[model samples]
Target: MSKLILVLNCGSSSLKGAVLNTENSEVLLSCLGEKLGLPDAYITFKVDGQKEKVDLSAQPDHTGAVGAMLDKLKAMGLDSQVGAIGHRVVSGGELYSDSVLINDDVIAAIEKCIPLAPLHNPANLLGIRAAQNIFEGLPNVAVFDTAFHQTMPEHAYTYAVPRKLYRDLGLRRYGFHGTSYRFVSEEAARFLGKDVHNLRLVVAHLGNGASVAAIKNGQSVDTSMGITPLEGLVMGTRAGDIDASVYEFLADNLNLSVKEITNLLNKQSGLLGISELSSDCRTIEEESLNGHAGAILALEIFSYRLAKYVASMAVAAGGIDALVFTGGIGENSDIIRTKVLNYCEFLGMNVDAEANLAARFGNAGIITTADSKVVSVVIPTNEELMIAQDTARLSGL
Candidate 1:
């Protein structure tokens, strides 16, 4: 039988899936089911070089989304012979050192972690449950977003909080976006033709939600994100690393509720709040070019912070050989990359401006000058494919 693996990444109100033909190493079908305002949603699939968007207005949640995707796959001549199902689980605590098959105990442990990622874990669970229901008796794998960072030591992962709270509430740093980091780290190793463990590298996963990680000997030594995704580099909507006292001040002075504060931090902040414009990097870039002060400031702060964090991570790794940029903004925004590299000149980093600008959204080599001590690279991350591969390995396919 042909081996195929289905990878699912679930958000608060949406589900993203990729059906991979593991034998051929191709994505057979990829779809996103969005649930914004309406009770139901629509799924858009990329199949056979054609884009097909289907309205599954009858199904309300992720289970419905999975069913809809399955039906569409069947219509396209795909069947129920899937070899495995992989879920991008957001938090794995310290229990999971690597990808593992999902059993009832795993599900329960994931449930216990919901408080750590209230907005994400439920959706992930729904996806897992839905896939389990749709593909009965099939091997399901849980690929954690925190698994790759399990290598971080106490000096890097610990918070300054009291020891009791740290022990009781599990309040130490549990860096997110591990899947992206893992994929690109391995890819960087492949591109350099060196064992990943031999390199001292830092990876920046700069998307709508962004973070930076320091990898030493192929193990995550440190990362910017903390106990939640809300900490790290500035994001499209998230406030990232803000003063903790702000929450208390707002609650006491402005009489704001916790939910309102959360909404503001998670939705109304970041580039959107600072720029008073769109949260998208493309829009921010356009507006900055037009001399929008806030937009320009937002971009400046974002780049400056990224550069500063990359330098700090270098300290943890002792020194850096390569700095990799990935995700949406990191891969596509040449202006941002240029700004970041310029700020890192003190660390012996220099980007070939012409080359940096030309490498946008393409798989290219080093944008940094050969004479520079630190080489800068742009690598696009493929978390779905990584999950599929992990699923295949876990299923013994």
Candidate 2:
């Protein structure tokens, strides 16, 4: 049956929505719904070869942005047949291992996880609730970003904290970006014409937010991000890994509160913190070429840390057979990819410089020589499609 699935990836600052036709596997409508500069916000719908941007002045908050998103879709003739609205919830904790129909209980459970992903879960709930209110009879499903990593073993997920804290507070390594990692990993296997269960892969998802996963035998044996997305590689604004005592020291010396420290780690660190310039990698790359020392340092730290983590994850999985790069920075930044691959030569990574340089954005291909020991692939991530496919399968749309 033909089905229309609307995928919603809600974040602390913006809502990214896409309408996909499962029958032909085409995108009908896709947009970035952003609320910025005021209580009034806007939604830009880019789909089906058409671009429409609407200014929604003063409608309160994220719910308002989502409402604007629906209004625009309806105006663009995509509202009536939407089979399901698939939401990407950041931290599903240990509750959900896959996508399911969103009900009141599911909503409550997601809300309960807000403390774990304070900046994300609330916005995700807003998107879900707004869709329920606007779309009415359609089934709204929750596809968790953490669900795919639930297969991670206890040894990889356990923290060395007090047992009570882990037992009582559910403090463990619940990885994020599971949807992206799952899609890219499967794509890597397809590109190699190999069964997923037969491949050991290290997928580097580099964007404003970055994470690495060690996928062995088609399952996530270990991933970089832990408990929250803040624990992985340096991100646009997040601090990846810092000394545990840094938080305490900030609280005592800087007179910061726990909430303040959390905000600092989640919003003020990473590339922005190290470069003291911009969070966007493209911007940093440009500035570094222009002799910006901070930008150079940020790029070095980001790529070196990525290499270090990829190597570590390889150890977690015994050894990696392939290194797959996805996400924005992973696909477009050839210089960064080259630098990362150079550092990974110990794993027998041999870059085909011509192939790496000739690669274009949005296309996947081998970036390593045919004789390279560890195959290197640049596979673009398609999280929206993954979310839509899961939503359709689960909703039977």
Best by TM-score: 1
Model 1: per-residue lDDT, tens digit, 1-397? Answer: 5878989999878889999977777888889889822665777888877988777777677888888877986897776667789999999888787999999999998999998888888889999999999877889999999999999999999988899988888889999999999989989988978799899999999999999999988989999999888888889998888899998999999899989998999999988888999899999999999999999999998999889899999998878989999998988999999999999998889889877987776565688998998889999898988999999998998
Using Cα atoms with residue i matched to residue i, what is each candidate's TM-score against the true structure? 0.97, 0.95
Model 2, 1-397: lDDT tens per residue?
A: 3668988887766778888987787887888867643666777888767888877676645667767777776787766777888999998899998888888899989988998888789989878887887778888889899998999999999999888998899999999889998899998999899899988999999999999999998888899999888898989999898898998899899999988998998889999999999999999999999999999999999999999999999998889899999999999998899999999988899889999986648878899988889999999999998999989988887
lDDT of each: 0.89, 0.87
Full-model lDDT, candidate 1: 0.89
How high a TM-score does candidate 1 get?
0.97
Q: How high a TM-score does candidate 2 get?
A: 0.95
